[model samples]
Target: MEAAGEPIPLSALQHAVYCLRQAALIHLERLWAENVFTAEGAVLHAVADKGGGRHARGVRRVMSLPLASRRLNLAGVADVVEFPRVGGQETPFPIEYKRGKPKLHRADEVQLCAQGLCLEEMTGAPVPQGALFYAATKRRVVVPFDADLRALTEAAAADLARVLASGETPPPTPLKARCRACSLHDLCRPEAVARPARAWRDRMVAAEVGPR
Candidate 1:
């Protein structure tokens, strides 16, 4: 903790780590859009955010809990945390909610790992693993907080801090795939940018070829 009354730095780290343009839109522009995907995600989160404590067998489930780790510069709410006792000692297992099914990308893993790090810091317990529940798939994917993931999480936090401090909206590196599904497609105008770049490159090539 830096000091009392100090604002805890935002963990827009996940946004930056996932996509620079997305981070810029949210942090720099304060713009947001809720598409169908985001709406479904919000519904899932709303159910999880309802505070309640439940016990099943030997596992206790806690919901909508605020968690943070100053060491990791991470702050977020864990959707669900399972505390399982072994030999009369409580161990934490974090669970995060996702809007879609698992993909080839590791963005979701990064988010889950950050949450686990926060749980460890807040509770002073070893959190070796966590899980992400996908609303679309209706399944849970387990994530291990290994050394590599921890390093990535920490680096992401630092990168987010740099971006926020700079207060600059980063230019979008538009990909056809990203543009197709991006919620900010209209705002970003990635296709327009890509077409111009392609045209410029073609003109340069034509000039070099001498009217070819």
Candidate 2:
């Protein structure tokens, strides 16, 4: 729980899940760098970012919907939230735009679930599920806001709030695969920075073993 402060950004929840250090760098250090992948994502969100509402296929589609949850202390703009009639009542169905396909990790799902939580607070309606729309696949992967996912989202929010308030950037956890896709790769320099730290740890271990 944040106790008191600005609401944590919903996107920070994803960053926290993906890598806590990455979240700290962006939220604490205010660092950012764009790359091809991020540009593609921007293109995908161009229209939705404009922010408006419309009715399509009997569903009310709201773009760039601002969402906030006091319970989680999270706030951000949902790319698209469709209010489709469920049991004769309008229910929020958040649709997040992404550049890549479904990932093995649950970072994206956590973000979407946070949006559902915000919607539940704002609309006083149960947000049971949402969707992640991948630009590459051009498909929507439906996500249920089950107990596990909701728990993960809440946990991410708490972790993110803690990191942001700590006022210190977390150490780099270098992963070749994940860092390669990050827009802040150059700024992060995970490999360059983590190598020396890893080497130092190895040296300490060797020293402790005493030539074994």
Candidate 3:
């Protein structure tokens, strides 16, 4: 596990994209678990890894490519990075594998964009686009590194840093859907912290002073 305030892992950004508290729980507290969802996701990535460094048509496929951006203080592995021969030039395109279908949130996209940033920083070239391969759909969805996505990625990284600096796990999100399927559901106990509680003084007064 990485120490708080150190170079934040790329996974932290993904967690932050889901929920800040969840990110803190995993990154700051070193808590994790595996559920069916996570297990399937791992399987999908393993398949991607086996296809390492192969050339097909004008594309060179590299699997499990390590990436880092010192400027952003983030590090992670890209499931697949494709270098396409376009007009006699090679362009880096990152592809992320997911166990589920695409969601309304940008958690997965932010992760891809961050990979592009790392590639850019290392190669001094702009990564304009990437793709996400969803296990449920088994299709690639193209994502452009426009201004909006770049900003979102940067913000997620910065927020992760803030959460690490504070050294406190954020409270659970109000939306229960986010908690129901998490592997850390039992450990996080979102419902436990959400419940209202009587003050300690009030309990003491009731016990020792008066019932009414």
Candidate 4:
């Protein structure tokens, strides 16, 4: 749980889940770059953000809603939260907007789960499930608020808080897959770190053998 006056951003959880280095760059350094994918995502979020107020079809759709979860130490603006009528009362359901289709990554889920935790804290209600709206597929994927997801969300949040408080940017993992799409590729220069580490090792080995 987060202390009073300390707010955790939902994006932090996603960053921690995806890559610690990315999270550090975004939160610690306040560095950002908009790529093609991110730009499209911004457009989608804008549409949702503009569609304000609650709807009439037993669905109260709130866009860009601010949320915070002290227990998870997470906070952020939810893209949209649909309150469905249940037993004559509206139940909260968080829906997140994504630029791409679902992948083999838990990053999206961690993000949504953090949002759910925030909504639960803010509304004093139990959010059992949420939805992910993907722009590429133009479809909604339902996410169950299971024990595993909740645990992951909380753990990620705690980890993010620790990282942010430390005020240190973590080194990149330099996976080819991450490098290809990461907006911080040029700035991070993962190859540089890897090459230097390898070179240093080589130099140490050479020095050890030369004086014999």
Best model number under TM-score? 2
Candidate 3 matches the true fold with a TM-score of 0.88
Model 3, poorest ten-residue lDDT window?
193-202
How do the predictions measure up, each by TM-score? 0.83, 0.90, 0.88, 0.87
Give the runs in model 4 whose Cα sits over 4 Å from its true position.
1-5, 197-212
lDDT of 3 by residue, 1-212 (tens): 45654688887788899988888888888899999998898888887677558887858989888899999999888889999977787889999999899988899999999999999998887799999999889899999999999999999999889778878787775567788877888998877775533354467779997776
Candidate 4: global Cα-lDDT?
0.81
TM for candidate 2 is 0.90
C-alpha lDDT values of all predictions: 0.76, 0.90, 0.86, 0.81
Question: Measured by C-alpha RMSD in angstroms, how accurate is candidate 1?
Answer: 4.8
Q: Which runs of model 2 end up more than 4 angstroms from their true locations? A: 1-4, 199-212
Error of 2 at 61 (Å): 1.2
lDDT of 2 by residue, 1-212 (tens): 23358899899888889888888878888888888887888898998999999999888999999999998888999999999998899999999999878998999999999999999999999999999999889999999999999998898888788777777687798877888888888898898888898899899999999896
Residue-level lDDT of model 1, residues 1-212, one tens digit each, is: 12332323334655666677777787678788777876887888898889798997869999987888877555667888999986688889888888878866676787778888888888888999999898878899889899998898778776666666677676667766655666777877766766777788889999999873
Pick the winner on lDDT between candidates 1 and 4.
4
